[model samples]
Target: MRIVGISVLCLFCAFSAIVFFTYYRRNSATFSYDIVLPTIFGNSTEFNTSEIKKKRRAFVVNVFASWCTVCMQEHQTWKEISKRTPIDLYGIDYIDIEDNTLAWLQEPDNPYIAIAADYSGKAAKAFGLREYLKLLFSTKKVNWCSI
Candidate 1:
């Protein structure tokens, strides 16, 4: 009976841990660090978190690649948002070639106020980008934007 009780308790603990982990993973902000990235213009810069807090209520960080079809599709939307909104827009060129990205930006009127280069995708991983996007989009704010 003692052994059975211990087994049951262990199982219950495992189940509880799984539930708690899932909830935290889904709901919590995974990236809790300042992000700095290399700029297309050959400079490294930090995301203006303080500026965004003071000036714009929010900012969008978009992770994009020059070769991404989905990114191309959404380019116009980003442009319009930048033009019309009070929110700040920033871009991360995720694992993209510099020349290709510059060329891509040239024709369509670059919408981003600043662009960051993430050649190795380390920045994207640090940001927990996939989960962050889910959280941002799920928010009540109509202006869902980010890299």
Candidate 2:
């Protein structure tokens, strides 16, 4: 009788822990962090990271590679999202050549509000990207004319 009671209590505790973890991981905003630079791309005269962040209420930083086929596939979805939504889009041109990135921007369906070149991968690394592949979200006022 004593051994059976102990087993039941352990089972109950295990189930409780699983439920708690599931709720926490799915709903918590642990992965979202404020980006340090606002407009990190293009000619300095055209866009500046610090300036854009100050002007826009919220923005998205997409970590992408020019050669990444998955990133390529996601481009259309991103384009649609940009056109339909009020959200500001920023690109972290992750680990790609300057010329290739330039050609990518020249694509018929350009969607980025601004592009930041991250050749050294330091910015993405600072965002602790390798820890996990998660999408970060934030909310801010929209300035539609800027786009």
Candidate 3:
């Protein structure tokens, strides 16, 4: 009985430690702007990571899909933020159709100064983005915007 009790306690502690580590790892993950992806622009332009890094201006990279309700809800807030802050806003359309994304932006205001298409989801994967809506901020230190 004593041996069984000890084994159960050890298992519980191990499980708890795993949960804690996973939570910490997920929340503490950081994203960098060193990635370069093609833009949605007609000019065949791309998101110039080197230029952005050189400028060192604080900017926001919003990863969203046209079909995501949470993203749509946050769109207004992004527009408001753009008006108030000097930060440049960019959008990454994650695993979405370009036509749908364009049509969605047409009805509402586009807060993004530039838009990129992540049709293959590689950009999203590279950034370690697991959520439908993720806002990455490029500053002196790279961080994820909670809002």
Rank all candidate structures by their lDDT, best first, as comma-separated numbers: 3, 1, 2
User: Which one wins on TM-score?
Assistant: 3
Q: lDDT per residue, candidate 3, 12-82, as tens digits?
A: 99999999999878755754446788888434488765666677789887899999999989989998998
Candidate 1's TM-score reads 0.66
Give lDDT tens digits, candidate 2, residues 48-78: 4446667656667677877888888888999
* Model 3 per-residue lDDT at 21: 92
TM-score (all chains, Cα) for each model: 0.66, 0.61, 0.72
Q: What is the lDDT of residue 69 in candidate 3?
A: 92
lDDT of each: 0.68, 0.66, 0.80
Please tell me which model should have the higher lDDT, number 1 or number 2: 1
- Name the runs in model 3 displaced over 4 angstroms: 1-33, 42-44, 107-109, 141-147
Candidate 1 C-alpha lDDT tens digits along 66-142 = 78888888889988988897656677788889999998988755778778788988777766666323112212254
